[model samples]
Target: MDHKGTIVMQKYELGRLLGQGSFAKVYHARCVETGQSVAIKVVDKAKVRKAGIMDHIEREISVMRRVRHPNVVHLYEVMATKSKIYFVMEYARGGELFRKVEANGRLPEDVGRKYFVQLIDAVEFCHGRGVCHRDLKPENILLDEDGGIKVSDFGLSGVAECRGADGLLHTTCGTPAYVAPEIIGRSGYDGAGVDVWSCGVVLFVLLAGYLPFHDTNVMEMYRKISRGEYRFPSWFSPKLKKLISRMLDPNPSSRISIAKIKGSSWFKAGKEGEPVKVTSDGDEARRLLKMNAFDIISLSDGLDLSKLFETESCLDKGCRIMSRKPVAVIVSRLERGARAAKMRVSKKDGGLIELESRDGVLAIEAEISVVTPVLHLVEVRRRYGEAAEYEKVLNEVIRPRLVDKAPSSLLRHQHSLSPSSGARL
Candidate 1:
């Protein structure tokens, strides 16, 4: 309410468009009453419903509500209306840590060590809270005005409840370059160990200004990650190299734990096991302290999420299943195979080909994405009337036609509709 007695519909004063994603847009904003700076994430409910990822969004909110560490981004409140959902969060004025790495090429040893400590501390905090940041990368880390670390974007995060009977997460998620070997193995992996591996990769990037696992080939990259076959630069110290080796070990059991990392001589050198001291913003503190638990009921009041559970037209409509064949061969085989199967060809663009079954019972989509000279990924999907029909088409009609001499290891490991949801065939 302002002095004029008229009602103000907008709660925060939106400044600039910070960033935009497929379903949401982030903006720089200021609290109307307190005049404090904040970042507001405005999500389109319609898009969320259409994409069928409302649960992922809710999980993100739930996990963020439980985290209150200095290195983790502070999620203040969640407000919603009929169509839009808003998340008020602490604003990071300094932008993503990626920008810093890009501008400077590589950071000094001391600087890399500093950022590594913060990242580890943040991961430790999240794991302690029964949360795992599945997607850990430089772009997900934000820097405050004082150049301090703040882990953001829990959209791909998983919590304790997601753990399987074996007490490991089976989801294959995260950026390819940073993902652990265990994740690419298609076997269940320990969340904590996975985060540690990603953090180790981030540390390497900070110091070397490039990914440790490098190849024009995705399968080759996975092979390198699986074998723990990355080399440290000449500039890296012996102690740091030793620590990184332990962290990047292919065996999760052999990988260095966060507790061990904290106790390591290299990690404790300058700080002597003392954690970085970051002061909380006054407004942020007040907001967080006032609201402890996430009011999911109130947040979702009057909201209908039934559409989110229904199978809407496939969102993002593609998968990245690895293949070793040349692009020309892969494309030709796909087209010829679709024709041989008597499907009505609809369109072809670059490596993508679309076809519909003659009887109109199913729609087939296929595409090829080249990761390296020798390694490529074939994306395939079939949309049908029911789950059974979809599987029938996949196993009986589609699978046999697309078989290639490419390494079986490619498709055997990484093929899922949505990694976060743990979708598999």
Candidate 2:
């Protein structure tokens, strides 16, 4: 299916074949001008038409564009010539799971746990936005140079809410080994359920270094999946063993949902590796500790506090001078760019300094035991004194956009570490 146009193949400068799929051939390509490496998946139109896979290919690209997650591949550009469709994607330096797992023999339990949680988190984001990745397998997950897994290949993915009641994925897609029993049995099943089931299988593979239900006979694999029988390695934690059991449940209705999956004891068990340290300094402790409504007399940070405080004697006949409580500005994460939005209080450390609005109106990513003092309603009221209105405004106004990106008055700062979540407020 070769169609030649004025478009130059040398422009792409294909280096080597990255991998070959049933429908497409991917290559490591470089831009002649910029010298940037990219993965280009070329799908032959004739082959696509022969297999009647145009719809799947269309949906695959559509799904990939809609999903924006830290652990998902980013598609840079797509182009089509007379005979070939090209998908240009970010090049990941890390190799395939086939080689990665082969090198490690088996992944460590903690390592498996981290990847599993990230996988679920990405899926949860998809479900939240009404999409479901119907096919999830080790081969479909690509890793970056840092060993971070980026889920790819959305060709078999479908919208979870739009799926028919028959739940059979309507397409009979996904790998044979990772297919949920419900899917293989032709029972209508939710798309989300099947994905979770596959995740369970992946977990099993990670922990035991083998597939839970494998047989040369397809019928035997189905029987095991239908019966939902699987065993744990003796070395596996009880929590993990129990989690996989629930997730691989034969009944879709009984299968765990991704949102609730995180709250599961097994998922929470891994978090015990560290006590959360939310602060980097004593200033953070004192700033988070004292929060009260102040009589905020101005919208500008440069408003003369001394001058404003000196003018409070009009209501008091005897008092010549009146004192106003200073506004306690505590900066916290603003949703606009989804960065750690904060109010920069001081530049003493030669770094970005932000203060949390004293009135707990913003947020603290802390548990009750550590953040109890600020959250105590009675204490908040008592500490608020006569400045309750300041608390109301802090919650309603000033604290919302402390670090927003577009059209924000907050300090100009963007996170280099986690830049994906930033959005305009």
Candidate 3:
């Protein structure tokens, strides 16, 4: 009904505008067919385009699709049209983790420990799947009605092989106070280690109601992070201090891993009932079945797609293609479609077809893998380029062919569409 069009309205009954960020707004919505309450994030493609952060958006989508854990927020579906991108995500009724910390100042040790355990479980699951969440903070964590944790926001996640010669994730991003020493050093930081560091900071804040490293000066903050300089408050249990110290170690190589952390006294003490698994059915399951992590990273250049997909978990890198098309047939059709779009195409091992921008300034790649005798999965990625242009090419040129070649039984086309309740905020 509004200028944004009725595309989102056809499927969802938008309730109220929940919240707004620079490029997107969250709204409470109910599925027209199922009447299920969902948080729909309507991202303004124009705003994202202007800001050149479409890749970040794509990365968030890709990362969320690959992960399925009780502690992680579930991404139900992604729909996009000409104007906006709609992310149908699970509604966390209890709101942001930051709010709880703000109200309580400091949580009870047991409560903080419980949240930390849930966080660890989610982070551990992600790492095992070869995905690293670069940003971990109270603001990014959410709570559900049952007071369970739901880690959200993956705009800064690192998707790749868990361990490779590629060394560290060189990206310098994340909230400064929660960022790791290695990430601040920027000499290339291990994805898992930096993530652990952030988690450590999160744990500290959950228990202490303050950052372990603080400074009015940015330089001082960086210096503190680099030195891993932070004193545990006297109120902290010795066990807690020891565990946090190990997680926040300045030397990433020597930093405590999730496995060791799990075995630690503090972590073990905080353990409780298992995480609550949100039900995935119908469209959610189907979309997840065909979801691939590498597809989202294709816009970046020179990244090794093969290594990332080589993991043992079939569900990790590639989504099952619900079509009957053979791998070769699918690759041929995609290559043909890409060539027609004036993009350069090159065949690679492992059913990969690499694409180069008309001028060879950017690179993108796609692959089709046979997961079972009848089920196949198609995955795409961007090697590296301008985020805005890559998004355009992906949506305008590549996505159509992907949908066209995909079995109609498996994919549905829709316009793009987040979160909250009550009157418009």
Candidate 4:
């Protein structure tokens, strides 16, 4: 939208303005060679420089250049003139996913199952290549006339594989409602784990036509998220609840693995390669996104996660006073030699954690529930910098339960939960 030198698409006739963003404007255009419809995204170099996204824009082009999948959006070609950069992409005939959700109400199980598989397959491909789609939601997923899902909007997408100083990711990026707790806690987290968490949220939205974690007040939502609290209506099946719980685990370490997600009962039960609805005419698979309720708010609007650095969670400091919220815990993990280990230290009581390292890999299930305490207890003390002293209550009342368990048994302790329960802020 902001540019100087003009390179008019004199060959390809430009039509309606499809969309606009901070970086570019997209228009529906017809290719002179084929007379076929295509969407053109024109970006200005000066705007890229002003936003300090020149690197991101290049990374996006490089990433898009390598991706070759039917489920993912295809970039036809790129052209750069002095004033503008061009991205010509295949036009998805169908409309937004959010519009279909709002108009159709809660989709039938079969309908959701079809779309879920498509979305997962797209995500699986990205993960296979060491990429993490930081943003995954209804708005970014497009539908073709045939009801196929086309994953678009790669502006926020980038590789999360840590091959440098820390082998863990700590960027406080992603939409708040769908973000993983490890991200919220400012502890380094596995990129794959956080992506799965977001996918889980998207899955919930597809089936229920509502967000599981919804709050109007920003801080209020943060408080609810901190507590790992969310509610699903009684009418939803128990199986759905189980899946959502695993996806929304308060601890990223505990979130369900993508492998488990693909093999889950919900996904496995659905028909293969089908649309949302199957009719003789095949019109029900995907509803058109044009003029839908979802269009009222462009889904990509909040996707530019660069704004997160403005939060107190900026990575420059060892500890950040996050949004005036009481700093309660410091959670961290180490992965080496096939072992992914985590330790949460009492914030009030600081010292080396004498944790028993697992002989093999960290049990994925335990990582979610148990490791949270390791981080929080230490954070509570670190952020407060207070006189509150921690007591070794576990040894006095809890050591007896270790007799038969793999890890020291915590049932022997008086507290209903292992050290993980009642983790303080």
> Which lDDT tens digits does candidate 1 get at residues 258-306?
9999999889985865766654444443533454323222122112222
Candidate 4 matches the true fold with a TM-score of 0.62
Most TM-score-accurate candidate: 3
Model 3: residue 406 alpha-carbon error in angstroms: 12
Estimate the overall C-alpha local distance difference test score of candidate 2: 0.57
What tens digits encode model 2's per-residue C-alpha lDDT throughout 1-425? Answer: 33222223446667677788787987888877788888888877778878876756765654564465668887765555556677778787785654666677778888888778778877876765446787787787888889888888888887532344332346577787788887887756777888899999888887778888888998887788788766777888888888898888888888888867888988876667756634343543354344221111111122221221122211101001111211122222222212333322222121222233444333211111111222211001111122344344334543343312232221112111111121111
Model 4: per-residue Cα lDDT over 193-308, one tens digit each: 87788888788887778887779997778777767788886667888788778878887766788789877787777745545543221231122112122111111111111221
On a 0 to 1 TM-score scale, where does candidate 1 land against the true structure?
0.65
Native-to-model Cα distance after best TM-score fit, residue 177 in candidate 1, in Å: 0.4
Cα TM-score per model: 0.65, 0.62, 0.68, 0.62
In candidate 2, how many Å is residue 244 off?
A: 0.7
lDDT scores of the candidates, listed in order: 0.72, 0.57, 0.71, 0.55
Best by lDDT: 1
TM-score-better candidate, 3 vs 4: 3
Decide which is better by TM-score, 1 or 4: 1
Give candidate 1's error at residue 147 in angstroms: 1.6
Runs in model 4 deviating more than 4 A are 1-11, 160-164, 271-425
Clashing pairs in 1: 216-372, 323-376
Candidate 1: regions farther than 4 A off: 1-9, 273-425
